[model samples]
Target: MDRLSQEKPLKILVVTQYFWPENMRINNMVEGFVAKGHEVTVLTGQPNYPEGKIYADYRRDPAQFSNYHGAQIVRVPIFARGQRSLTLALNYLSFFASASTIGSYKLRGQSFDSIFVFGVSPIMVAIPGIVLGRLKKAPAFIWILDLWPESLRAVGVIKSPRLLGWAGKVVSWIYNRADYLLLQSRSFDESVKQYCTRAISEDRLVYFPSWAEDDFSGAAPVASDLLQRDDSVFTVLFAGNIGDAQDFPAIMEAVKAVKADLPVRWVIVGDGRASQWLARHVAEHRLDNVLLLGRHPLEKMPALFAVADALLVSLKTNEVFEKTIPGKVQAYLASSKPIIAMIDGEAAKVVANSGAGMVCGSGDALGLANIVRSMGALPATERERMGLLGRRYYFEHFSKAILFDRLEVLFRKATLRRSDK
Candidate 1:
C-alpha cells in the first residue's frame, strides 16, 4: 500500500582511514550513495594526510568535519602518520585498534544494509568493517584498491618472506570474511583469487573501477604562475601523490637525460611521503626543468590539467603494480589531456588502448625520456586527438553514473549472498 513497502533506500556504513577534507576517491563514493537517497555513515580517522599532522581547522572546530554530502562522519583516535616508517606503522595500528573497539562502540545501536570498506594500501583497515558487518548482520563490501602483502613488498616496506607470508594470511582472512570484494582493476582478478586460495566464487569478485569525477570534465582553464610555458618546450604535468610507489628516482633519471638535450619541463603538483626526497633530488642534481609546486586543492587540479600540454602518470616497476590502475589515469582521460604513462601492466594497457598517450615500461628512465621527446615532437593536432579518444574511452568504460547503478545492483546481490555463510 505504501511506496516504502515496495522499495526502500539502503543504509550504508563506510569504514576507512581517510575521508572528506582529505582528498580521496572514497568521498566521491560516499557522495554518490547519499545523492541516490541512501543514508550513509563514515567511520574514519581524523584528517591528516600528505601532511602528517591533524588539520588545524579540524582540531579547532571538530563539528565542521562531522557531515558531508548528507552522510554522518564518525571520528576515532589515530596517530598522525608523521613522515617516518615507525609513525606510519603506529598510525595504521591506531586506526585498526581504535576503529575495531572504540569505533564499534561509537556506533553501538546503529544498523546498516551494507558495510562499505575503503580497502586502501594497508589491508588491516578492512577488519573493522568485517567486524561491524558480522555484529550488525550486514554484508561487507570491500573496495580493494591495493593488494596487501604484495603492495608492501613492492613499496619496499616489508621484505622478509616470513613477514610477507604472515601479511598474506591477514589478506586471506580478510578475503574470507567479506561478503564481496570489489576490485579497481580487472587485472587483479587472478592475483586476488589465487592469493586468497579459497573458494572465492566469481560473483564474489566484482570488477568495479574508479571513475573520473565531474570536476575533471570541462574545468575552467584558469592560468597559474607555476607553469613554465614556452613555444618550444613541452609542458608535461605529473600530479597526485609523490611517494615511493610512484618511482621518483626513475623520473629524476629521466629528467637528467632530457634536460641536457631537449626542451621539456615537468610540472609536479602534489605532496606525499617522498616529496622531500624528490625536492632534494631535484635540487642536488640541478634538474631546473623539474618544477615542484608542492600540494594544491582538488579544485585546482582541473585548472592545472586544462593548461598543461599533456599529463603524466607513473608507478614503480613491480609485478603487484602491474595489476592495478591508478585513479589519476581516469582523471587524465576525463580532462581530455594526452597522457604519458610510465607504468606497466593494466594501467599501461588502459593508456595504450584508449589512444590517450604513449606508454613505456615502469622505471625505465631512458624510455620515459624518449617518450617525452617524442610527445613533444608530435603536432598539436595529434595531441588533441589523443585527448579526445581518452575522454571517449572514459565515457565508454568508466562512467561514474553507470558504475553507481552497477553498485546498486551489487548491493542487492550482496544482500542475497549475506546468508552464504
Candidate 2:
C-alpha cells in the first residue's frame, strides 16, 4: 500500500472567533490544512474583525463564504463589534453562546476525526471547543493565541482584583478540561501551568508559532498613493490593529522628539479602539512626518510592505505582554524589511536574534526616538543586509509548510478518535 493511503485523512472541525475576510492567522492555517490532505471544516462567526463590521461582500452573500480552500465554513450568528466597548463585549458573548448551542445543533448529524480550536483572545472559545468535542466524542485541542485575565488587565479592560480572580477561575476551567493546549510562544508554558488547577502533563503543551501567509510572499509591489517612491526620507511602516496594547502614546512622544531632527516618515495602516486618540494627538502635535492611514484590505499590505524602508512593531509595557509575541512580528520578518520594535522579552528577542533592526524598551519615548535616529542614519547596504537576515529567519523558523506538518502530527496523535460519521 502507498504511504499516503496507509492512514485515512483526518476530518477536522476548526472552531475560531475569526476566519477568512478577517486577516487572521487561522485563515492561513486552515488553507494549509486543506492542502496537506486533511478534510477540514471551520466553525466561526460573522467576518467583522479589525473594523468590527461585517465585510460588505460577506453581508451581501453568505453563500460565497461557505467554502474556503476546500474546507467548509459554518457561521454562527453574532452581533458586529462596531468598534465600541459595549458592542465588542456583546460580540464576544454572542459568539460563545451561539457557537455552543446553535453550532452544536447545526453539526448534530456530522462527526469529526478531531476538533481543533483556533484559540485567540477571549478564552471563552475553549468552552465551545470542549462542548462540541464531548458531543461529537472527539478529542479537542486548543491553540493558545492569547492569555486572558492577564490580557484583559494589560489592556485595562478589567482592573479589579476580585473580578480578575473570577476570570482566572474561568481560564482554569478551560485549561483543566482540554485534551491538549497548543502554545504559540514558548514563554506561554509557565502561564498555562499557573492557570490550570489540574496538573497538566508536560506533553500536553506544544509549541506552535504563527506562520507567514503564502499570499504575502509572492505579491509584487503595487503602485498606490499610499506608498510613494521617495529616497530623500526614510519611511517606517506599522500595520495591524491600532489598539491599546500597541502603546501608541509612547510612540507619539517618540515621534515628536525625533520628527524635527530626522528625515523619517511614520506611516501606520489599520485602526482600532485607539484611532480617535491617535488622530487627536497627530493633529495636536502637528507631527507632519506621521501619517495615519486607516484600515485597508489584507491584499494591500504586501504592496505597502514592499515600498517601506523599515517596519515598526510595538507592544505596551506589561509582564503579560512581555511574554506574548504579537503575530505581526512574523509578518514583519517575512516582509524582508528591517524591523524597529518597541517591545521587550519574546518579541524583542526574536527581532534581535534575527538581526532584523533596532529595538527600544517598551513605552520608552526617548529610547524609541534614539532608535529611529540610528536606523535613519544607517547606510542603504547595511539596511539591505538586515532585511535579508530577517527574511532568512522567517523562512528558516516561521514558514507555514513546517507548522502545517506539526499540526497534522497532533491531529493524528489525538487518540480519542470518534467512530461516528
Candidate 3:
C-alpha cells in the first residue's frame, strides 16, 4: 500500500491556545503535520491573542467540531473579551479547564497515534495531553514557544521569585511527561535541557527555527515609496510588536540622537501595549524622525522589509530575549534585507555566523546609532551583498521545506515506535 494507504494514517491531536487566522508559530506545526499524510486535529481556544480580543466570527459552541482544510479543528471558549488582567489569566485557565474536561470526556475514548501541544499559558494546556495520552496510549510531543515562569519573570511581568519557582516545578512536571519536546531556538533548547533535564533528550530536543511562506524572487526594488523616498537618508525599519519585550524607547532615543546629523529615519511598524506610550514619547520628545504605522497584515511584511535599508530586530535588555529568536528575522531574511539586530543572545550569534547582519547590546542607543551609521557607510554593493547573505543563510538552515521534512521523519519514527511497542 502507498504511504497514505498504510495500515492506518497517524492520528494527531494538537492542543494550543492559538491557531490560524491568527499569526502564530503554532500554525506552522499544524499545517506541517497535516501536509505530511497525518490525520490532524487541532484543539484550541477561540482566536484572541496579541490584540487580547476574541475574534467576532467564531460563536462559542460547547461541543464545537469543524474541519480546517483536511484537518479537524475544535475551538473552546476563552474569556478574553473586555479587559486584560487576572481576567486574561482566567481566560487561559478556562481553556485548560474546559478543554481538559471536554477532551477527557469526549476525546479520551478516541485512539490517536500521538498528541502534540504548544507550551504556553504553560502547564494548564498539558492536562489534556497528559490525560488523553495516558488513556488513549498516544505519545505526547510538546513544542515550547516560550519557557514559562522564566519568560514571565524575565519581563518583570511576574515579580515573585517564589511564585515563579512554583511555576517552574509545574513546567518540570509537564516537561517530564512529554515524549518529545521541540524548542523554537537552540538557546532555548539548551535552557530547557538545563531546567527540565529529565524531560528532554539531546536528540529529541530539536532546533527548528520558524519560517515564512514566501517565494524569494529577488531583492525587492529599493523602497522608493513616500515612506522611504529620501535619497539623502538611510531608513532603519523596526517592524513587529511594540510590546514589553521590545524596547522602543531606546530606539526612539537613538533616532533622536542621530536623525539630524546622520540623515537616518526610524520607521516602526506594528502596534501593541507600548505603542501608545511610544507615540506619546515621540510627541513629547519632538522626535520627528520616528514614524509609527499601525499593525499591518502578515502579507505586507515582505514589501515593508524590501524597502528597508536595514531591518531592526530588538528586544528589551533582558536575559530571556537572548535565548529567544524573533520571528521577524526569517521574514527580513526572506526579503533579502540586512539585519540590525539589537539583541545579545543566540540570535545574534546566528546572524554573526551567517555574515548576514550586525548585533549590539540591547538598549544601547549609542551603539545602535553607531551600527546604523556603519551600515549606512557601507558601499551600496557591499550592503546588497550582506542582504543576499541573509537570504542564503535562511534557505540553508531555516526553510519550511527543511523544517517540515525533519518533522515528518520524526513523526514517522514516533508512530512506528509506538506500533512496535
Candidate 4:
C-alpha cells in the first residue's frame, strides 16, 4: 500500500502572492510539499518584494506559468511590489482579481486533492482559494501566516471600528470556509480560533513553526572580512527587515544608553522605510554605537549571524506583535547564537522555554541596554553554553527534517480523509 501510494502523487494547489526566490515561508511550503512526494501547483504573482518592483526577468511576461525546481508555478498579475502604501494594497488586490479569473484555466481541469492558501494578503489571496476549491471540489487549508484585521489595527493602518468589524467579517468568512487552519505560533492559533466563528475542530487547527533552510546546515562559523573585529567590543546584530514593526527606534535608544558605560556595538542590517529614518535619527543624535548596514544579500547572512556575540530580535509594543515569532529567531537558533529578544508574548515564551535566549519587556530600551551590558559581561564559556542550548532547541523543534515529517503526516491525513469520504 505504501509503494502504491508513492507511485500516485498527491496533487496540491498552493495560492500565495509570494513564492520561491523570494526567501519567505510561503515558498518553503510549496517546496516542502513537493519534496514529500506531492506534485505541487502554485498560484502567485510575479516576483516583486521588498523592492516593490517586478523581477527583471518576469516584467515582460507577467502572466506565465513556469517550472521552478520541482514545483509548477502560475504567475498572476500584481501591482509592482513597493513601499508606497497604496501600491501594496493594489498589488494584493490585483493578484486576487487575476488568480480568481485565471486559476481554473491554468490548471487545465486537473483534480487536486487539496488547496493550501497562504494568508498574508488576507482577502486578496483568499478569493482564489475559495474560488478554486469550489471549482475543483478540493479541500481548502488556510495557513494563517499572520492575523489579519487585528494586525492591521495594531499598526494603526486601519482605525475605524466599523471598518475593522467589516474586515473581520471577511476574514472570518474565509476561515469558516477552510477545511483546515495552520498557524505558526500558539498565540496565533488561539486568536485565529476566536476570530473564526466556524467551530473548527481542534484537529483541524495545527501548529507548524517556520524553519531554517537546508543550506544552513553545517555552515561555517561566522566570519566577516568586511567587519572589523574588536576583542574589547561586544557586538549585537539585528539582521532582517528594519521596518516600523521591528521597533528599530527602541533598539537605537537602547544602544545609545549603553554607549557611555560600555563598549558595545549595535549592527542594524537590512533595508526598509524605517531603515532610512533610523539612519537620519542616528546622524541627528550623533549615535556612535549604532551602525546601519542597510540590506545584505541572503548568502551573507550567515557570516553576519556568526560575528555577532548575540542576535537581537525586536517588535513594536502592540497586541498584534505579541502573537508573532520573528522568522530571524529560527536563523539565530540555527546558527547556535545567543539571542536577546525585545519582543513580548509568544516569542519571549519560546525564548524562555528553549533556554536559548533572554527577553526583556517590550520597547524597554533601558532594560534592553542593561541586558546587553550583562550579556557582554558573561564569560565566553557561559555564552557558548547558551548558544548550544539554542541550537539544540532548534534541532529538536524547528529543523526542516522534523517539520517535514509532521507535514507528511498532515498530507497523508488530509488525503486519506478525502479518499475515505
Question: By lDDT, who's the top model here?
Answer: 1
In order, the Cα lDDT scores of the candidates are 0.89, 0.87, 0.76, 0.81
What digit string (tens of lDDT, one per residue) describes model 2 on residues 67-174?
998999999999998956899899999999999999998888988878999888789987889999899978899999898888888888899999999999999999
Q: Which stretches of candidate 4 lie above 4 Å from their native place?
A: 1-7, 60-65
Q: Pick the candidate with the highest TM-score.
A: 2
Worst 10 residues of 4 by lDDT: 1-10
Residue 236 lDDT in model 2? 89
Listed per candidate, the RMSD to the true structure in angstroms reads 2.6, 2.5, 3.2, 2.3
Off by over 4 Å in 2: 1-7, 54-56, 416-421
lDDT for each residue of candidate 4 in 131-207, tens digit (9 for 90 to 100): 89888888888777678888878877899999999998888888888888888787887778777796888998989
Better lDDT candidate (1, 3): 1
TM-score of each candidate structure, all chains considered together? 0.94, 0.94, 0.90, 0.94
Q: After superposition, how far is residue 154 of candidate 1 from its true place, in Å?
A: 1.3
144-193 per-residue lDDT for model 1 (tens digits): 99988878888888899999999999999999888899999998887788
